[model samples]
Target: MRLHLRLILTVLLAGFAALVAAGPAAAHVVPSTVLQLDVHEDDITVEMTLPTTDLVTASGIDVPVDGTVPAAAAEQLAAYVEEHFDVTIAAASDATSATGTWNVDVGDVATAEVEQWGTGAFDAVTATATLTPPAGADLRSFTLDYDAILHQVVTADVFVLLRSDSSTGEVEQTRSLGAITLDTVTGTVSPLTVDLAGGSARQGFTGMLLLGISHIAEGTDHQLFLLTLLLPAPLLAASLAGDRAGRSRHWREVAPTRRAVRRITTTTIAFTIGHSLTLALGALGLPVPQQPVEAAIAVSILIAAAHAVRPLFPGREPLIAALFGLVHGMAFSTTLSEMELSGTQLVLSLLGFNLGIELMQLVVVLLVLPPLIVLARTPAYRPLRTTAAVVTAVAAVGWLLDRVGVPTPLSTAADSLGSVSPWIAATLWIAAALVLLGTRGRRSGIRRVVSA
Candidate 1:
């Protein structure tokens, strides 16, 4: 119990730390302005998220509170944004580098009610701006001269973050540059200087690797589907003498360790191959029907769960694993697609992310499967496997219904599985250890009795 509590607390603390570390400047109780920059070879694009109340207070544009801006006010808002925001090249350390201002274009003024993490719901205005440097100016390091809301609302803070930089191989990860706020003691706003470091292909690949690992770590549905299929891998399949379905089979005695290991290895590799093919295709702009793919993944889990109870495809677990892996890969592709990567960056991301997924998958199997193999030889195996399969099947059905546009309490409960998964893993480890110890003790007693 102490171990379980420690595991749960560790997970919760890590999550909290992540949220806090995301934006160091965003620590105020009230809403703050957020500015995200997308760096390219020749230019940078700025995405501005302005609190509606602060925008009106700063520019006096008469914006409405109902999350709408009038046509006249929208133009005024765009002009106001253009007037206050500017990007300039940073001076070199040697004092020999040229400096110039970039051309700024602000458009697509829109308003909506957005709920930011930890800040709840608030009315906000969002706009996109492009900053293009002069013919030979550096785009990596620059001075941001922005005072949209802070000019009037002295207490308002603005967080500057790097959203995507292809040259730096920073796709799918956000880096905080710095914050633009008034110096309380000096009571003055200074220009924000953003200096981004150089990056190589290796860095990009590593980033994708971490992304893939985290994706699978947090993706409970994907983990469940794969784990459930491996549940019956240690047992042999026997033909039921008078089965209704002619091809039906049931799980029987435990297979030799070597056979079980062989089956498990083949199934895992097959799954990897299956998903890798579709993940590449989907990342390369293949159209993936999101809802149907998600639903199909749930259906795959359902089939795997049923197989765990009664062997649906006795000797062909690898083939089934591969087939279902294709659906799971499509779901994985959605994450990369949202990153909006292209060319070399996209290719590298594909490699890194796939590697990450495989590494995490292997770790999970190593941690849980060996214990199950030991347990499979014991009398308690049948009941344990059935309970796991039934629970998994229920979660699958809940997810299936939810993905198809129906909501249920079962679906909500299934979502909580990820939070409790660490505890579950801990329990499995302890159980396996106890089982091994008990078996060893029994063997020792029998040997002593024979000697006496």
Candidate 2:
């Protein structure tokens, strides 16, 4: 019991330590801004409204020219805008235009011409162009490039909005500034194909892999589930008696580690397969009920948590993991469904997204595995194990209830765990090391007493 308790403490400490070291890479959202796009038969129109707050945050450019600034500062700001805001239109055929690229014919665009349209607000700046297609030109397909904010502010995302109005109502389309391969020195925008139409099969597979790995890494629920499953492993070994304890020890001791790796691997793979299946099914136009799928995931987690406390089915964790994984996978498909991928681009996105997910998962697993295995061998593993397990079970139950249409503090508390992962990890490491050293000292003292 003593040894088991020590082991539990060690694993917990290690788990916590890893969580702390993960840093701010976990909570960041992808850089996305809303842009509405509209297309017409004769021409295309783009209107961009920059949010001052987001612009300031992303780039140091503080818009809405402060009247408080000196003349030099104001002049510098104007110059920056003049140099940065630009629009370029490329013709499909070189014969259509002399240079093949047409700049918005606003002659001698100057810093002084850029005016402040509103007070203390990021207002709309509109640039319009009407082009007549060549005698045998393709109007449906042409290159439209805008480097308005891309030059001075490379990191800042520019979203282009287009709206078309005819005899009927207005139709709108929006697209993010796709991969703009910029020449650092020349400040030229190189065109790269944006796979909005969803790429080939190979691409889709890669994207799915990335998406899967990412989902797991950022998934607090998944991490919590793994932690809970591992929480009682070390303690289970010390609970056995004498040689039976040792014999039970060999199996039980090895059981958690083997099972843990297996469970994680199985769950992860199953989750990938399950989600991929659903993603394909959903993406391929299968009608799936969303609410029920979500509810199913919550129920699955609750079941897994309950099973973790006391084996719902002994020696069958992997099977249970695979089953629960399927539910989790279905839940994951929700993100891909919104992407609206078609043809080759869809395939590429699926592949790229999935690859990203796998990379993150592999990193997380490698970071977490070592300390977990080390702690399982220590004496003080059991009590701590049970405590962690109990806590996990409670949280899972809360999630279950919440999923079933009841809101509670338990769910909120569980959700907030990621925020404190760093602190929790640090405390665990310190506590586990201290306990291990203390246990070693106590063992040394016991030997001296016996010899004396």
Q: Which model scores highest in lDDT?
A: 1
Q: Write the per-residue lDDT of candidate 1 for residues 329-391, one digit (tens) a residue.
A: 999998777566788888888999999999999988897789778878776667667767877
The numbered model that scores best in TM-score is 1
Stretches of model 2 off by over 4 angstroms after superposition: 1-213, 232-273, 377-380, 429-432, 435-452
Tell me the tens digit of each residue's lDDT in model 2 across 1-452: 46545554565455544543443223323332233443333443333344444444434644453334345534543454435443333433445443333333222211211222122223322222343334444444445454545545555555443333211112222224443435777767654321122223554464355456656656777666555544433323333555552333322454456655765666556555655666666655666677676667666656655554554554455566567656655566565554444565555555555566557656655555545555556544435545566656666677777777898766766565555555544545655576678778999999999999
Give each model's clash number: 0, 66
lDDT of every model, 2 decimals: 0.81, 0.50
Model 2 Cα RMSD, 1 decimal: 13.5
Over all chains combined, what TM-score does candidate 1 have? 0.81
Worst 10-residue stretch by lDDT in candidate 1? 19-28
